[model samples]
Target: MIRDATAFLNRSLAVISGIEVSGLALVFGVLAIFFVLLWLRASGRARLAQRALQTAEADAARLDTVLKVQAEMSGRMQTMAEIIGSRQADLTRALSDRLDGLTTRVGQSILSTTRETKASLSVLAERLAVIDRAQGEIRSLTGEVVKLKDVLANKQTRGAFGEARMQAIIADALPSSVYAFQATLSNGRRPDCLIRMPNGAPGLVVDAKFPLESFTALQQAADGETQAAAATRLRRDMDVHIKAIAEKYLIPGETQDTAFLFVPSETVFAALHEDFDDVVQKAYRLGVVIVSPSLLNLSIQVVQAVLKDARLRASAGRIQAEVRLFGEDLERLDARVTALKGHFAQASRDVDQISVSSDKLQRRGERIAGIEIGEEAGPSEGLKSVAGE
Candidate 1:
């Protein structure tokens, strides 16, 4: 019984040892499988892990793979989120810049519109004010025109104005000519204006006969009939005025070769040009030239050569008069200057003589002072002391 027990015990012990070895082999096999799965995961071979693994006691392996996949997805999601966030930040910054630019432009437009509106309103108000003032002035001007008509009709008043205006126009145009108003010609009819031309001859006679009534009538004529009558009357009146200017002023053989009929009003000149060009042609043929003040300036230039000589003759007479007076004054001044030079020479000689006398007096005073010193010191005794020393 003891031997049987010992054998059974050895057998049991061996069986237990085999079971423990089998359990250890199984544990080592599971550990080796886990190490392979762990290595595959570490090496980033998830596909190989999937092919090798299943729903066994490999929870950590499967968990490791799931965690790794989750971590990768999280990293990819984080990168995408970072990209989206950066785009959103960039878009926000761009939008903010565009909004800032649009706001500045809108503000500038508003300011410009405000300034323009103010300027336009100010201009409109100023125009309305001007219109109001002008309307008042126009009413006043109409009243003055009636009074002016009476004054203009007076002979002395009209004649004085005509003469004064003609004088000014001639003086402005011709600087060299000797222009005179109401000058008595050789015929003894005092022409309105006389220009002393070159060679001491009368250059041209100017007469100021303004046909204001006829010109005004032509300006105010309503229909063709009135306009034609006014125009005919104006022409006939102008022809009479022209003939009068010629008879009174123009002396064909005596006074001047060509005569000037000065019409001061540009309105008359325009009328003559428009309705009466034929009259202008006829006047020119008759050696009676019509001159506007502006044209008369140029006309004066044309005869300037004649006027220059006349002016030179007058200037020569004036220069001779001045020379005579200047010569007398120069003779008087020359005598005075010569006497003054002599006085200065004599004074210089007297001063030299006084300087010589003063030098002699200084020498004499020095001699006298030396003699007094000698007398106080005993002269011979001093001399002996000097010799002994």
Candidate 2:
């Protein structure tokens, strides 16, 4: 039994050891399984990690390429900024220069306009002053014209004015010696004036009375019938005055052959020529010369010149006579001077002969006085006779 029990214990011990060994083996197997699973998981994780690492390497390469591209773009951008800055500076300077030139031109234009405005104002003021003065002068002239019209309205006043104006013209044109006022002619008729011509005959008579009333009536007549009547009267009046002047003033050997009918106004003379040509022709046939104031003045000047020439001719005769007398006196004076010169020559010759004779007598007396004769020597008879004489 002891042996069986010992064997049983040994068997138990072996079974226990087997069981523990199995458990240990199972644990080891489980550990191995765990280790295997862990190993598998580790392998899967390692494969995923390897893929991720490959992906990271690719991404790093791409990032490095992008950085290189970015660096190049930044360099280009800096260069473009510098070019833009230079362009802006040039534009600013150009605009500033243009503004300065425009300002100067505007200033000069303003000054020119100011000067032109001032000069135009000055000229306008001067013209205004001149216009004012001319207006005043025109007003004064109007007053004088009114007074002259009033003076011409009356017959007596008009006649007197005409006579006075004629007198003034005649006086201004001729010397007083060549003309006479209100002179009587040989026919016992007094004329307004007479102009002395160069001839010794009676002077030219100038009659100033004219038929002005008839002419004025003719001028003022409106209707044809009134004008015709006035013209007839004017012709009749002019014929009567001309016939009277020709009969009274145109005397042969007493006055000029053509007597002057003086019309003081040129308008009257023009009217006679224009409308009264027949009257003028008739007056010419009667030896009557019509004259206006201007014509009369010129005629008087001609008469003055002719009279002066005549006086000069008369004085020439006296001058010739005086020249002849002066020649005779000069000849007589020459003859008297010749006679006196001849007398002076004869007197000089006589004086020379007397001097020669006196010199000879002095020589003889000296010789007689110088002769040293003895006391007893009697003087010569010639010497004694000379001393006694």
Candidate 3:
């Protein structure tokens, strides 16, 4: 179409050149308008091409920068992956080591606790055994207490018990030679014990029998009036026993002025002293002394001390005689020692004189040996030289 339009334009221009001058002016105006339109279209096309080139360059720059940024980001991500893997490995190893330590500590703690629990159980077992043994001993003690209660329940057995206790105390405190059990006095009455005093002093009697029924009743009384009646009966019974012991045991010449009324029970004796003071005074006035087991033991100790003093007094002359003989023997021994010393001194002086004589003889023998004689000298001449030396 553009070629056709160019041909048409060429024909028109030739036509216009041959036409009149008025027609050429009109033709020139139309050519100018077409040229201006062509120029404007060409300018618009150039500007569009420049804009497209600028846009393509900008797109290429943006693509290159995006590629470079993507590559850097990939490197950083790879480095971060390596760091994360290392950190994970380190954390795993650290956690493993800590877990191992914790496991070991827990195992040791469990073992220690087991051992401590075993020790505690063993100690508890031993304590339980000790408690079992103690319980057994308590049972045995309870049985023995019951037996003792039974023994004290009977009056005759109780009386015998009191006598046995009194005898045991006396036998332990006094010698058999100094005391006699159930000895018959001159009046044909037998006393429980007769203690022979020292230095031909009168014998002392001990009566072990005591009344305990009224005292037992007093202890068992339920009311005030009953208690008072029991107390009165106990006082009367005590008075009767005191008088009997005083009358039966006391002898003017053969026995001591005081006789012992032995009350084996300290409780009973204390009761008598506390509640029945008048009875004790009456017995004291009648030459009968009420004695508990402790009092009897003490009295026996005093008697033993008196006997020891009397024995010492009786042996005074013999001890003096023996001392005199010992002194004489000491004097003799001293004199003999003095004589022996004198003999030793004389022998030492004799030995010294003998040593001096032997030294003198040795010197003379050396001088004789040192003397030289001529080979041709006669025997008589040598003898004479020796004698002269």
Q: Pick the candidate with the highest lDDT.
A: 3
Clashes of each: 1, 0, 0
Across 174-239, the per-residue lDDT of candidate 2 in tens digits comes to 878778888887778888888777657678887777877888899999999999999999999999
In order, the Cα lDDT scores of the candidates are: 0.76, 0.83, 0.87
Cα error of candidate 2 at position 307, Å: 1.1
Please give me the total number of clashing residue pairs in predicted model 3: 0
Task: Provide the lowest-lDDT 10-residue window in model 3.
Answer: 8-17
> How close to the true structure is residue 24 of candidate 3, measured as C-alpha lDDT?
45
> Residue 160: error of model 1 in Å?
8.6
lDDT of 3: 0.87
Weakest ten-residue segment in model 1 by summed lDDT: 9-18
| 1-389: candidate 1 lDDT, tens digit per residue | 98875554444232443463344455566899999999878777666566456544377787888899999999999999999999999999999999999999999999999999999999999999999999988988888677567756675665565566677877877764367777787768887787766664655788876666677777789999999999899889878877777777777656786688777667678768877998888788766888887787787777776566656887998999999999999999999999999999999999999999898778666654555463667877655554443
Point to the candidate with the largest TM-score: 3
lDDT computed for candidate 2: 0.83
- Which pairs of residues have clashing backbones in candidate 1? 198-306
Candidate 2 regions with alpha-carbon error over 4 angstroms:
1-145, 318-389
In order of TM-score, best first, we have 3, 2, 1
